[model samples]
Target: MFKIRNIGAILLVFFSISLVNAQIKIGDVLPNITLQDTKNNAVKLNSFKGKTVLVDFWASWCGPCRLANRKLVKMHDKYKAKNFEIVGISIDTDKSKWIKAIEKDKIQYVQLIDPKGFDAKSAVTFGVEALPATFLFDATGKLIAINPTESQIITQINKK
Candidate 1:
């Protein structure tokens, strides 16, 4: 009975670790997503490879997203010259509303609209179940952080 119990415990631990390691964790190469920018031009994710990029998934109707955008604006202005870039991906069904929000917030970064809303391919590919979700990628295009805080982003930007 003791041996059987020990085997069961080992299996449980193994499965737990596997589950934790399953998702797109840090250091993973982000998938390339080509989408239309606010100007209706096609933009590829790889275009930002040579710079540190922040890919933010947000929605116009989400209050938290708006708040996060405000913070992002400040961050962008502070680190833009340091090779830091922000790509705002809006999962908004209404193109007009998305454009309006971008103008109202004065977002100076690249803004992309996903007309599929929550079901957007980019959102699904990134497993984004929440608004204001952000992924930070290094100059080499390797994802360095998932859902990082404002300070965390700043720290990464400051790193050599």
Candidate 2:
């Protein structure tokens, strides 16, 4: 029994290490992954370089995500001309659900799905493990903040 418990502990440690290693961090260059937009047009991250970027990781099923969309839409309208852009990375597994939510919520920002689901390359690159995670970047494309709230977006914009 003791030997079995020790083996289990070893396995747990290895699993934790792998998860940690997979998480992305500050200073990591955003990977250039392209996905179809709500309009079914291909959009790439590289196209938004030299602009302030707000990346929101969400899913169709998440209530907070839906709520956040309303504020995001307003922010998009407010700062878009200032070269600020918001992008939604949907971690939802169902394509229909993602598309429906985008329409239902009237989300005006650019939206994309992790066709690979939650463990998608972009999610890993952003070290995202939770829904409604947000990352803000400067015009130079470096990460400035992570997981900021709705009001914080306003403050950040005003600062810029």
> Which residue pairs come into collision in candidate 2?
none
Deviation in Å, model 2, residue 94 alpha carbon:
1.2
RMSD of 2: 3.0
C-alpha RMSD for every candidate = 5.4, 3.0
| Regions more than 4 Å wrong, model 2 | 1-22, 150-152, 155-160
Per-residue lDDT of candidate 2, residues 52-71 (tens digit): 78988999999988998888
TM-score (all chains, Cα) for each model = 0.83, 0.80
- How far is 159's C-alpha from truth in model 1 (Å)? 1.6
Residue 126 miss distance in model 1 (angstroms): 0.6
Model 1 scores what on Cα lDDT? 0.88
lDDT of 1 by residue, 15-112 (tens): 88775654456887767789999989999977898888899999889999999889899999999999899999999999999999999999999998
Least accurate stretch of 10 residues (summed lDDT) in model 2? 22-31
TM value for model 1: 0.83
The 10-residue segment of model 1 with minimum total lDDT is: 16-25
